[model samples]
Target: MSRGFTLLELLITILVIGALMVWAVPSYSSVSEKIKMERLAKELSGFVLMAKSEAVMRRERLWIHIVMSGATNSSGDWSLELTDRDTQGVGNRLLHLSGKPFDGITLSNTYTSDQISFDETHGRPKSGRISFHPINASTDLLEMRTYHRSAIVRVCSPNSALYLNYERC
Candidate 1:
């Protein structure tokens, strides 16, 4: 016999590899999505905290408008703007961030108003919650809650069972 692999052996190896891939792809995709959601929550929280600090340091009102809208699993755009109203009453944009990272995600907030304002004296917005949910999945939900005195970015699952690296709400 020649020192070469036979057709039968090659076919078996390919089928095993294919089977493994079929089994592993969904798990990998789910994990990837969870990571992305976590990152988004953390980044948003950081931005809000930064705005709060800026308002306190500058002693001026800073308004943060977080807007997200679109059908789930569809291409959509979201934006966050930090503005300050000058003496002339013209709004000055301090920092603006916009992106379409929420391709298959849906976002909702519990705040009464869409605009959150941090006064010069207090570096906090009214207590509320911002939640992120995947369109097709039910388990990887994440939320961030802010308190009266501080802006805390808590990435927790609303589900009863814990998922990924997040704690249960």
Candidate 2:
């Protein structure tokens, strides 16, 4: 009896494995991208909530500055920098958050100003949406929204086809 597989059988197995890999690789890459976006969204939402709470607890306003990078001013890595709105001489940095390198995620927001601020009285922020997605792909968008009357930040997906378990925006 043969101890090992024949040449034909080995070739067939190799072909099948290659086919499966071809089918799975792209899906895996896509899922990974979505996951990255989701993670950033969640983190952003949490930070916004933290800023709101800190604003109320400290009885002071807070500003989250959005900094963008890249040549065209729209594609590359971005970060959130938290600071007190009342500080002078740029010495009151509280928190800073940035994504992992090479993720190629870009940030866009609907804020009327470059910064998102929380009120000291009620911790309510100006209504706006902050979004994170891949550099050139919009299908994997994840958004964090703040309402004018609520301190809670909501994370959701605008594109429902990405198969993320988050609520729809």
Candidate 3:
């Protein structure tokens, strides 16, 4: 016989490769979503920290805004801005951190209150929570039909006493 794989051996090898692909594909997709969620959370945290730092360093009230809007699997839009001196004044666009990583992700604030302001004196936040949901589906317990994805990343600042990484938020 020639020094070549037999038909039976080749078939078995192909079967094995196919089986592995079947198992790997779904896992890869789920893991990708998880990674996206983690990355978005980190970016948001960094943005918050940056605001805190700027406010402290400049020693002036720094008001910032973040806007997130996306309906479905469509990529969402998030832009950061610097508000005029007046607390409720219109914000001038500072930077738009391309939210492509979080395109299909849903970002909603649990508190939905203040426009995130850091005091020049202490660099403290107004105390709130921002929740990231991968899909628009709702969770079982919350039952609000707002959050769908089980994988979530939450940025929480329970009180104004929060001092970035230095203190509990």
Candidate number of the best TM-score? 1
Cα lDDT tens digits, model 1, 1-169, are 6799999999999999999999999999877777767767777778788888899999988877765563223243777678885222248878876647756666777766466777788787667777777667755677777777765546677885666667787
RMSD of 2: 3.6
Report per-prediction Cα RMSD to one decimal.
3.7, 3.6, 8.6
- Two-way TM-score contest, 2 vs 3, winner: 2
Give the Cα lDDT of each candidate. 0.71, 0.75, 0.55
Prediction 2 TM-score vs. true: 0.76
lDDT of 3 by residue, 74-131 (tens): 3566554555343443545443456666776666554343356667776666655555
- Which one is best on lDDT? 2
Of the two candidates 1 and 3, the one with more favorable lDDT, higher being better, is 1
Please give the range of 10 consecutive residues that has the lowest summed lDDT in model 2: 68-77
My TM-score estimates for the predictions, one after another, are 0.77, 0.76, 0.62
Ranking by lDDT: 2, 1, 3
Distance (Å) between predicted and true CA of 1, model 3?
Answer: 2.8
| Residue 75 C-alpha lDDT in model 3 | 59
Regions of candidate 1 where Cα sits further than 4 Å from its true position? 1-3, 70-76, 85-90, 149-153, 161-169
Residue pairs whose backbone atoms clash in candidate 2: none
Residue lDDT tens for model 2, 19-59: 99999998998777767776777688889888888889989
